[model samples]
Target: MSKNIIITGTSRGIGFELVQLFAKADYNVLALSRNSKPIEALELKNVIALSFDLSKKDDYKKVESFIGSNWKQVDVLIHNAGTLLNKPFVETSMEDFEHVYKTNVFGVTELTRIAIPFMQRTSHVVTISSMGGVQGSMKFPGLAAYSSSKGAVITLTELLAEEYKETGPSFNVLALGAVQTEMLEEAFPGYQAPTTALEMAQYIFDFSLNGNKYYNGKILQVSSSTP
Candidate 1:
């Protein structure tokens, strides 16, 4: 049987590309996003579009429900939903910070928490991170909220990786660099992005399907220069 996969933020960009690529590979894809509109170009037999707001605390329960009602085991879980708030810390309001954390950190963590029960030993969990998560760039003065949330995401991935050394499933984070997506456009309008969404999605699909034991707990960075 084909592997079952769940991917969040499938409305557009990298997440959207991931949904298309996985479905094309015959994987049972549960594409989750706030918008439920189907991608006409990506119509596939094994793909299901689920509408849910990741920022809402109750959405995790919906995820669990969908899993229970559909599949017994989720072969892969991809936490790819994220947002970018490009503003200085002082100018960023409390609401903006909370919203960013709610979607990137809290929502992702809670979804993973609920997903663990359905994951098998051979299952894989992939979280999409950013280069900003690994390094602090003062040159990009207005991204504190977004960058800090991603940093927390990477730390969470590491903590989970170490904690699940025995019976836990494989966990990995992909630190995608400068992906050419709507998110990047929103972050830096009129600036050219180096990476394409479709290419990055294909790379991520290949990485997840490699079935290598050594890949577990690895932080794989995908960039224009990465070979």
Candidate 2:
């Protein structure tokens, strides 16, 4: 049977490429993004694209309903959608932090909560984080809100893995470096990244399928160069 996969942030960059990779591999993909036009335009086979906003509580129900009505099971769930704010800490407002956390942290939590019941021991949950989230690593200015939100998800993944260890649905997070995506450009303008969106998505696509075999609740640093 073809596996059912849910991937967020599918409007562009890594998430966009990921949707294609899974679809071409014969997996049933549910691509969610705030803007569904990009994925819908592709018209790929075995794929369903929805305009989903992570920060909105109601958006999760749409995902649950889709699964319940069509898939009835989730083989993989990848939290790839994230919001980034490029502003100095002193200049960033409380709303800025909340906005970032809303989507990156709380959003991940709610979706996983809704999807867990549909997943089995063999299921995998892959979260796409950033190297900026890694402690003791190089820190950059003007990213207090964005980077911290990414960091929060790292811990969230760890806790979920431990809690679910006895039951199933292995969890792991990838702390990626500067990938040449729109998000990267927004964070650091004009700075070219060594890896492309497709390249990174390819790695994530493979890992999401097999990494659970040997690892769980671990943070893998996937970066070739610093930002």
Candidate 3:
């Protein structure tokens, strides 16, 4: 039987490309996003599309119920969906921070919580973090909120790995550098990134498939020196 994988933020960017990679490899790809059109357009039989606002607590039941009813085992769960609020700390409002955290942190937490029941013993749960979240990295002035949110997930993933060690599943986080995506463009307008969305997607795909063999409760940094 083919493995089953769940990926969030699948409407575009790294998430979208991941859907393609997994689906092409014959994995049952359950793709979730707030909007469904982009994924639906792929028209792949192995791909299942789900729609819900990740930031909202109420929307989670749709995902939980769907997976609960249909799949007994999930081989992988990738938390690739996130948001950014690029503004100076002084100007960043509480709403902006909350908005970013809702999806970047809380959403990932809740989704992973609900997904654990269905995960197989060897399942890999992965979170896509940011380079800005890494300590000793050069800090940007306008990314206080976004970086903090990513940093929170990095820590959370580590804690989860330790807590779940007795269990069979593995948990890991990837602290990524700048990628060529709309999110990156939006966060740093006109800045060129060496890594493309598809490139990052490929890396994530390989990691999800086999990373657990070598890593668990670790944060791997992926980036070029130039950023």
Best by lDDT: 2
Error of 2 at 94 (Å): 1.0
Candidate 3 residue lDDT tens string, 73-174? 889999999888888788999999999999999999999998998887699999999989988876788999999999999999889999899885899999
Supply candidate 3's per-residue lDDT for 221.
93
lDDT score, candidate 2 = 0.95
User: Candidate 3, after superposition: displacement of residue 132 in Å?
Assistant: 0.4
Winner by TM-score: 2
State, as a TM-score between 0 and 1, how close model 2 is to the true structure. 0.99
The residue pairs in collision within model 2 are none
65-145: candidate 2 lDDT, tens digit per residue = 999999999999999999999997999999999999999999899999999999999999999999999998888999999
What lDDT would candidate 3 get against the real structure? Answer: 0.91
lDDT of each: 0.82, 0.95, 0.91
Worst 10 residues of 1 by lDDT: 218-227
Which order, best to worst by TM-score? 2, 3, 1
Provide the lDDT at 118 for model 1: 91
Model 1, span 16-73: residue lDDT tens: 9988888777899888888868543467788888787888767777789989999978
- Which pairs of residues have clashing backbones in candidate 1? none
Off by over 4 Å in 3: none
